[model samples]
Target: AQSVTQLDSQVPVFEEAPVELRCNYSSSVSVYLFWYVQYPNQGLQLLLKYLSGSTLVKGINGFEAEFNKSQTSFHLRKPSVHISDTAEYFCAVSEEKTSYDKVIFGPGTSLSVIP
Candidate 1:
């Protein structure tokens, strides 16, 4: 079985302030990790992913995450946040080397950026 967890359901931060959204996962087999962002009333977009390579992976909009295999964690971080960054973030995982990617998503963490 594979599952994802986001410790914080909601995160509030001031504009231009740094923020980190914590995520953890458990999988029996080798897996692929991902972060997805969903703007209000919009579809989810791929923020970043870890298939295979370096632990640290960078994504669009200044977002990045480190894959810690030992900890089973992939926490996303941004140096500075903007009001535009406000959205729901999801952590996902899928079996590696699968013919079709069927990702399992976390509950999602809503981020509110204050001015």
Candidate 2:
């Protein structure tokens, strides 16, 4: 079984500041890591993904994350954020070689950017 945990439920930050969202996962098999962002009342959009190869992965809007195999964690980070960056972030994992027909999502970290 695979499960993902997002440590923060919400992260409030001022515009142009930095932010980080932590995530941890538990799985007995190989897994694929992903971060998704969702605007208000909108569907989730793929921010980044770590399938294999490199541990560090960059995504849209200057967001990036590192996959730590030893810790089973994939944390998202951004150096500077904008009010438009305010949205819900989700971390997810899926077993390797398995179809993502039943992917699971974290509770989500609500990012509120203050102007």
Which candidate tops lDDT?
Answer: 1
Q: Please state the error at residue 9 of candidate 2 in Å.
A: 0.4
lDDT of 1 by residue, 22-69 (tens): 999998678899999999899999999999989999999999999999
Overall local distance difference test of candidate 1: 0.94
For candidate 2, the per-residue lDDT at 83 reads 94
Reference-based TM-score of each model = 0.95, 0.95
Candidate 2 lDDT over 18-92, as tens digits, reads 999999999877889899999999999999999999999999999999999999999999999999999999999
Question: What ranges in model 2 sit over 4 Å off?
Answer: 98-100
Q: How close is candidate 2 to the true structure, as a TM-score?
A: 0.95
Tell how far residue 63 is off in model 2, in angstroms. Answer: 0.4
